[model samples]
Every structure is written in C-alpha cells, then in structure tokens.
Target: MEAQARAILEKHHDNFLEDGNAVPAPARRVVGNFNVDDAKPVARRFRSIRPEHLRKAYDQLEKLFQTELIEYSHSEWASPIVIRMKKNGGDIRTCIDYRIAIQLIKLTHYPLPLIDDLLIGFESVLWVLSLAMAKRLWAVPMTLWAKHISVLICLLRHFQWTKMLLGLKNAPPICQQMLVNCLWSFVRLPASEAAQMDVDGLAFLGIDVGDSAEEDLSTLIEGMTVFGRNVPSSPQLNSVRGERPYICDIGYGTETWEQLCVDLDRRLYRLRYWGTSVSLLKNKFGKKRFSHEIEADRIQAQSKIAEGVIDLPSPSTLRDVQPFLASLNYYDEFIESLPVIAAVLNKLTDEQIRSGRDLGRAMEALRILKRKTVSTPLLRGPDSQKSFVIIIHANPWAACTVLGQESDGVFIPVHITGRVLHDHKFRYHPAENEVVALIRALRVFRAMLAGTKLIKVYNRYSMLKWICTSRSLEGRCRQLAVCFWKFARFSWMTMVWPQSWELRLPPPRDKLDQNDDNIIQVTGRVIQSPPVRLETLGPRCEGWLMSFDGHAKKSDRWGSAGCILWELLSWDVVQARGSHFADVTVNEAEYHGMIEGSKMALVRGISEMVIVGDSRIAIQQARGLIQCLKPRLRMLLSEFEDQRQEFKSIELVPVKRGFNAAANYLASKI
Candidate 1:
C-alpha cells in the first residue's frame, strides 16, 4: 500500500469491521418506507406453529430486544411470525412474513445496475477486486409508520422492527438507489490518478483539469461496503462462478497486477476516509475473472447467447420489441450485424407508420439478424489517435457501415453498424440515401473518431460529390446536409471508390435468405423499391382530396357507404354521395363506398383523385399489394380497379378511423 493510503486507513480505524457485525452506514436512512394505500391496515391472522418452533421464535424475539432491533408495538397492523433455521443449522432466525402488509403498501420502481455493462468494463484488465458488505439492508432505515406495519406477535407479546428489513418489495430497489447515489463520485478516481501519473492528462481527454469539488470518494468507499449479508457471500471465488448477475460482484480488471495493488490500496484508503470498513473475508484481490466477465471465455458467453441462454422470449406485441432488443444489446459488440438488426426493430417501434404494408418484411429481417448474430470474427479495438476508413451501403429499408483502420497495409475492422431509415428518408433520392447513411455512421462511431482527422469514405455509388454540390436540398435532405457538412469540416474527409476484395469482410448478400451467412445479408443495396409516387392527374379535379368511409354490421349484413371529394384549389366539395349495401361484408361495403364516390367523380369529368379511407384491407387490395383470397372480395376489387382506370390518375391512402370522421358521419346517416 502507498504511504498516503496507509496513513488514511490508520486514521479511520474505527470504521473498519475486523470481525462480528458490520458497522452501520455512516448515516441513518429511511430505506423501506412502506406507504400504505388504505386508511386502515389489515391485521392478518397468526399462522399455527409447532410447539418446539414457537419456543425458538420467543428466544429470537428476546435477542431482538437485547440488540434493540425490535420494540413493543401498539398497532392494528399485525403479521404472523415464522421461524426458520439458518443455513449453518446452528441457529434459528425469526421474522414476520408481512405478505398482507406488502399488498397494502404502494410499489416503488428503481432501476438496478446492469451486469453486461459491469462485465464490459473488465475487458483488458489483468487484475480485479471483489468486495462484500455484511448486513447491507440495515444501511437504509425505516420510518415510524413503516415500523407499525412490521409487527410480529409471539402469542402474547407484540413487537415491531426498529430498523429496515428486506421483506417488503421496495427494499431491494431502495437499497440500489442509495448505493448509486453514494457511488456517484467514485468512477472518476482513476482519471484523477491518471492526470497525476501521466505527462499530459487532458491532452488525450480533450479537456482541462476537472473541478476538485465534483470528484466523489464516497462512491468507492461506500461501494466496497455494500453487497451486504443479504447478498450471498462466496468465501471461495470458484464456488460462485456463473453467468452475469444483477448486483456487481465487481471484477473490473486493470492492465497489470501492480495497477491492481494500487487500485486496491486506493479503495482501502478511501473506505477508511469515509469512515467505513471492508470485510477482509469477503473481498478477493488479483482474481483472473469473476462470474460476469465474458472476455475470460468469450466463446462460452457467445455460445450461451446463441443457444438462447439469455432470458428472452418471442415478443407478442410491438411495444415488447424494443426491450427484447435492449436485452441482447449488452453483447451487441460481438454481433456482426447490430446496426442492420436495430434498423429492422426501429420499423416495428415506429407508431406513425403502422400501414401493415411491410410487416412480413420486418419479421424476415429480424430472423436474418438473429441468424447472423450467432458468431463473429474478432474485431480490433478502435484507436482514437488514428484516421478511419468507412465502407457504407444504403437502400430504402436500411443502412450498413463498416469502420476500420489500415494496420500493416491490411484493412482491420474496428466495428460494424446498421440502422433502419424513417419516413422522409425512405423517399430520398438514391444519392440522398447514401448521404443519410454516411451521416448516421459518423454519429454512431463518433466516440472512436473523436480526435481523428482525414476520414476516408467509400460507397458503391459515391454521393460525396452530390452532397457537396447539391443546392436543391429540402426538408429532411437539408437537415442531413448540415450534419454532413459539420462532420466533413471536423474530419477534413475525402470519398473514394471501394475495392471490396481488399477488405476481409464478406459483402452483404443480395438476398438475406441463408441462416449461416457470416456478414449482414441485407437485400441488394440497389434501390429495389422506390417511394410511392402519386399518379399524375389531368386537367379535371387536378388537386383534390377524397375522404371515404363505410359502416356495416356483421349480424345484419347491412350498411351504408359514403365518400366526399373536395377541390384543394377551392376548398369546396365537388362530389358527395352515400348508398346502402344489403348483402356485403364490411370490406366490400368500404370498397363500394369508394367505388360509388369515384363514379360520381367520373360523371363530373374529374380525371384525377386522391382517395383516403380508414379500411387498410380495402386500400391495400385496391393497390394490389394484398391478394384477394375470397371470390366476392375479388369481384369487388376488380370493380374498384376498373373504376380506378377511368380516372387519369388515382392514389389510394390508408389512415386511422378517427381521422376519417366526416366521411364516417355521412356513411352512418345513410
């Protein structure tokens, strides 16, 4: 240990717990505040117990009194007491079940730390320290009202807990919240040490000296004193080896053994400075790896993820999809096609475009992503000091980018990423798509390229010139141009034609059909599907909007159909009509309403029309994207198709029902 650290530890000797129970947290806290939802609390009936166990309960209660952990209580909220033998089988433990009390208390939600993030921090380190705390739950105290509900009755005498206990649902998250608050300042200690040890601290960081007041020591000291008795202790590290866990059994590594000793000393010194002690028996220093380090046996963790060892199931709804992706994101660096898969998920997550036009395509993309994520070749770590080369591909659906560096005259990949495009982006000219892809790649990999200059970009169809010279940018395109120019200025970038064979990575396959393909197999980067173009209207009713709606009851097979068409030039209804259909389904009625409305336009010699309807099935079928499976529906679609030909130009649009209220009102009145 360093002399300074040793002096600090010796100065706060009282905080250290050499043996017996742990010293309480530096301050008292109301941890498990059991706020009841009801005015009166229900006292649960006592559960029957064996005579011998009842005697153990009484003995435990007397010990609680001696320890001042419990006191005589006068409250209607009573809970049944239960006695159980400790794991050692040497002593009995007593506590109230509090099952009913917990139901009455309002729930609290606080996020716990993630294990994958914890493990990723241990990548190149050679040494790690695992520390534990004794009786951590006592770190957060309970309010007086909380104590009233925690009553335990040993037949005659009633008692309540004076300190916080773990029986309530909110206890764990409350403890987590407190732990995060206390450790908020500790993550910067290494940087503080780096500034002193290195010749230039802020040179690489791109910042000036940090404020001394913002640096927190309590985080490190308090962190070493967590992982209380409630968290199972592992005397032998080998015994507790497993996959990732919720609480950090921290094994973050340093590059060398000497660095480990220094970090250990720093922690010890800080813990003593904060008036806390480390349980020598619970901490393990200089360990190879702990339960969470995927790097120790990366293949094992990779196989586990591929084998579905991660706790994820097929999502049944659109809202469940993002979290499912997030669950797999911890290991995304190891997945070759992360950006492409994320793009597919983004389509499902968007609420505005629920047109149901590309549902099957999204599902297929998700499958391709899953199959591609099975394994990947190891990638070189990114070096911020060096310039970077990016190979990019983009289409209407998704964009893929590969970031790499030239090492020993060979192209070495640092990272791969992909993302789905949104509304206006999809309609962008092919050249604009490339510009969008480039802008997204720059933002995604900005961390690795922080200080890098002279970025080299390559694409199948180079759009660097288009981005530079195009003064016709509009809306989304203009925003993308501003972003691109900023990055261009920052990096002094140049665009070059790509030599695909020079890089080791396989080109994205033309079709994403095979399951075992190593690279992200996006559909051909060629613009396979162009954005929908409204049919060109002739002289009559040239710029007009049409709203159509249909009402039908399955029981009676009777409904009314209506449509209203207005000229955009005059804001007046050129045509409005409603008719009843006695023997048609809802889909048929909706199509008939649209067809009747179109006929009125044809009679009025209106050659062009834009039709909007709430029925997705009707609009999709009219456009021939959805095949008609039923014969009656086929005939109605054919009639609608014929009516479509009469107009010089026609456009079919689908929208939510609430937006088509005017047409719907006319339909229901008929």
Candidate 2:
C-alpha cells in the first residue's frame, strides 16, 4: 500500500499539494459592481432544517467561513444553501441556490476586452483551446461577487466572433459564426511550467471543448485560409509610409464573387486543397447553392451550343425539319411544355411533311417556339443538398417533365425532358400518359434524381393521385407503378399539384418519338400509331384570348352566359352574351357562352381562339375528355362542337375561380 501510494505520487509529482499553502491572490482583484440603488432588497425567513443534514450543512458553512469564502452576514440579504449528494454518492455537497437573489440583483454590462491590451505584456501569444472538461472544486456561498463572473462570461461569448475586436487575423466569416455559436469559453493563463502543471489553470470556466475540438479547430482554420492570398504591393493601396493597409472590417464588392471563383480555381490546382473546394464545402455545410465546378462546365456548354439554331433557314421541305429539330433538341432540357409547342414538328418526319399549308404554319410555329426556348435561363446542375421539384405535363399527343429547384426562395429549372408519343404503344389515356411522362422523366434523369428529395408537380390532379397510390394498377401501369415506388425511395419524395410558378416552369424542350427505345419490349411489342391529326392552329396563327362566365340560380330555373374576346392583333376586347337561357344548368350555360364567343369570333373572321374559363368541368368537357351525362348539357355540347368546326382551331383552358372577374360580373348582371 505504501509503495502504491508512492507510485501514484510519483506519477503526479509536480501536481502534489503542499501542506498549509494558501493560493496567492490574483495580481489584479476581480471587482463586481451592479447598479442596485433602484432595486428592492428582501430577507428570507430561516426555515426548519433536518437535524442530520444540518450537521453536514453547518460543517460546510464553517469551512467556507474559515476560508474567507463566506462571512457572518448581519445584512438584510440572506439566501439558503442545500446539502446534496455528490456524483460519487459518497460525499455531501453544499449548493447555494440563488434563484431569487439573481432576479433582484440589478443587471450590469462589462465592456468588451481589448485583445491588444490583453496581450500587452506577452511577447508572443498562443491560443490554447483546452479540451479539459471542467469540474467545480467547491461550492462558495452566494454573494454579489459571483454574479460579476457570470456576466463576464456572457460578454466573452457575445464578442467571441467579433473579428476586429478579437484580433483574429485571416479568419473567414463562416468560421467566425461557428466559433461564436460554439458551446465553450476562453481563458487567459500565464505561459509557464507551473501553470501548465496546474490542470485547473487550463480548464474552461463553462462548457469544455470535447475530443472533436481538434477536428473542429482544423476545419475552422482551413475555412479561414481557403480564400487567403498575399496582398499585392499596389502604390494606391499602400500608405505614404510604404506600409500595407490593415483592413479590419470586411466590405464585399461585385468582384468578391469573381475573386472567390479565382480562389477556388487556384485551390483546385493544388489538389490537396480540394477538400475546401466549393463543391465539397457545400456538401460539408449543407448549403443549397450551386457548386463552382459543376456550374462552370454547364455554363461553358450552354454558351457553345447557344448559336446552333441561329443560322437555320426557313423550312420549305421535309429535309429542313431534322436540322431544326436537332438544334431544338440540343437544348431540350431547358424547355417546358416542349411537347405542346412542338406537337406539329414531332408528327412530321422526312416522309411525312408533304407540301401543305399546315406544314408551313407548323414550321413557322416551331421557329417561334425554338426562339423562346433559347432565351430561357441556362439549366442548373443537380445539387445533392437541395430538394428538387419535377414538373410533369402531358397531353394525348405528347408527355414531358422538368426538373427544378428552389434556391434563395426562387424556383429555377434544372433540366427538362419531353417527347411526342407518336408510337401507339406509348399512347394511353391522358391521365395514364401523365403518369408515364413522370416515370419516363424519372428514368431519364435518374442519375441526377437519385438520392435527392423530389417534389413531383403535375397539372392534372387525377395523374398526381394515381402516381401516389399503389393499388388497382395492372400490367404496364403496375410496372410503371413499381418504377415510381423505386423513384420514391430517393432520400425523400413529395407530390405537389397544378403549379403555376410566380416564376413559371422552364421553357418547352422539343423531343422526337424515336429518341427513346428503352421503354420497349424485346419482342418488338411496341406498336407505332398514326399521328393523331390534331387540327391545331400554329403558334403564329392569329387567335383571340377569349374568356367566358356562366351564372345559374337553381331556384329560378334560369341561367346566364357572358363572353369576351381580346383580338390578337388589334388588342380590342369584343364582349358578347346570351342571357336568360331557359332550362339550362350552369355547366350547360358555360358551354353555350363559350360557343357564342366562338361564333362571335367567326362572324368577325377570326379563324382561331384560345378560350379561358373558371369552370374545370366545362373546360374539360369542351376538350372532349369529360362526358356530358345530363340531356341539356349533351345537346349544348353538340351545338358547341358545330360552332367549334366553324374555326380553324380552338383551345379550352381552365383558369382559377376568380381569374375572369370581368366575365363573372357580366354574367351576374344577366
């Protein structure tokens, strides 16, 4: 036992405590002051104490009194201490709970410590981040003194990240924020062997820096130096004394971002500094911003191919369609609604575009759509840290989806994919076509889509619902549904419907049907369908923007219809109505109103119209998708069909309920 004791003493010979040795008072006395003149003071009544615990508590009190940690108090202020078991469960600890006294004590603020002043006497100062966990050695009875230390600690933390005040050279802003938010405090100790030997001298007053401090510190330093470089000796930047300027406060200019790019490029050249590259740092910090490396490549590619369609001549023969389509196809990923815009071009092949007026109009529309697409923003590359939104739109003729993301609260396109489903095998119900489009999009962009959280947006509510459900699917649908489940296995996936972005979806990408063969079976089971001869007006085809509204009072058994047309060229709004239509439901009334508007356009020799309404049922019915089961509605649909034939082309689109306020007001007056 004696040898064991000697060995332990030998292990910590420098740390041995000597008998009757008092710790010397600090050279500078720590003073605390509070402006408590306006505060009220109170004294608590002494409560009955437990006899056994009282002995332990009184013993602690006597020790504190003897050590000058506490004194006999005849003042009005009195706070009690409680005896509690220590963590080891072998000893009692006296804890002074100052729950009430702290509140009554008036607040005080300490001026921030000056770093240069703090280091005035030292030749060279080193920052030692001690990883030692702190332990309170003894409990001192509560007094006005201890509160000052608490306030001092708060001041230290408040100014921890203040760079100019802290005298931290070459620290980055991000590192400053991280250090300020850290759960640790700093202390100053004299650099000596004796101080180093004393464990408490190096200890943190509050939370301790854990084992991860080394890694954290290294990361902070790396972040600080990632963009660091030597200052140039410019005469304009130097003082008259030829000394370099000491810029303590940071101010950013437009060139700051460009400098960051240059820094990143230089860092990348070293290869060892790649860990601090923009891409890696974004991954490290989970910042949903573009990576410097990937965006550079994408921008370069865009600039190179931007002029592919610029020199193309007018297409008079089938030979010209391929070159135009190829140029349009090169930028397919930036365009939304590509299938709709290029429907005419998609249907025509080298053998298909015979001399016809429709072909000429289709070619002209293709050129207009292509020009619009080129003007859209460059596609952003996929980001792992950011959540993506895939917008899918499909009509009977084609299907498409666009990948997008919300960055800095603005949604921007990432990639677009779409194709005209000229093949019969790919054709399905419009609802099914929408789902197929989503699945196709997911498959094509799986490299980017994988492991990213995706929000799927669709214009058709039915399609969104069908994709979200797993049951009642069969054959090809079941297969597509399986792929969807796999797609959802990404980091996360969500569904959003009928999105009209305040920042709209990306422009349309024109895709041909023959491009994708992966969806086909080995046995050539896929059949080709004759292109649906959609008698649609070209984009250049002059059309009026028509709006219709219908009103009905079931009790009165009467309905009203109102129509308005804004001429495409003249911008003249022509209004028309057929009110007091007897024995017609509101839905039938809406159909008649649109038909009356079309007839009005026909009378004015307008061959095309893009009709808009707030009624989804009416719009879908007019598009020949929804069946009119009611007798009067079916008769009105027949009459509407007859009027629709009088024009070269017509489109019925649904608007929000309150969108056509003028039309609604006109209908209500009837």
For every model shown, what is its TM-score relative to the native structure? 0.39, 0.29
RMSD of 1: 19.9
Model 1 C-alpha lDDT versus the unseen true structure: 0.61
lDDT, candidate 2, 1-670, per-residue tens: 2354244334433322233312222111112223445544433333334576667766755554465543433344444444566646657865543334444444433233333333233222121111110110111112243332122111001101101111111122222221211111122111221132224322412212232222333343332221231112222112111111111111111123333333222222211111111111111111122212236344332543446644456665565676766656645666665555665565555444544544554655566665765464556777878777766666666677778887776667788888777546344666777667777887887788777645546344366456556354646566765676755533223333223444454322222222222222222323232232213434455558888889888997688998888865564776566566887778877877887888788788988678888886788777754556664565566567656756788877777767688788888897
User: Which clashing pairs does model 2 show?
Assistant: 333-416, 335-507, 335-508, 336-507, 336-508, 338-508, 424-529
* Candidate 1 wrong stretches, greater than 4 Å: 1-27, 30-124, 129-177, 180-251, 254-287, 290-331, 341-378, 381-387, 395-398, 406-410, 420-434, 447-454, 460-481, 486-503, 508-670
Q: Candidate 1 residues 330-432, lDDT tens each?
A: 6565555565555555645344324455455456656655665554555788877777888665655567677888776666778877766654565677677
- Which 10 consecutive residues of model 2 have the lowest summed lDDT? 154-163
Q: State how far residue 185 of model 1 sits from its true place (Å).
A: 8.3
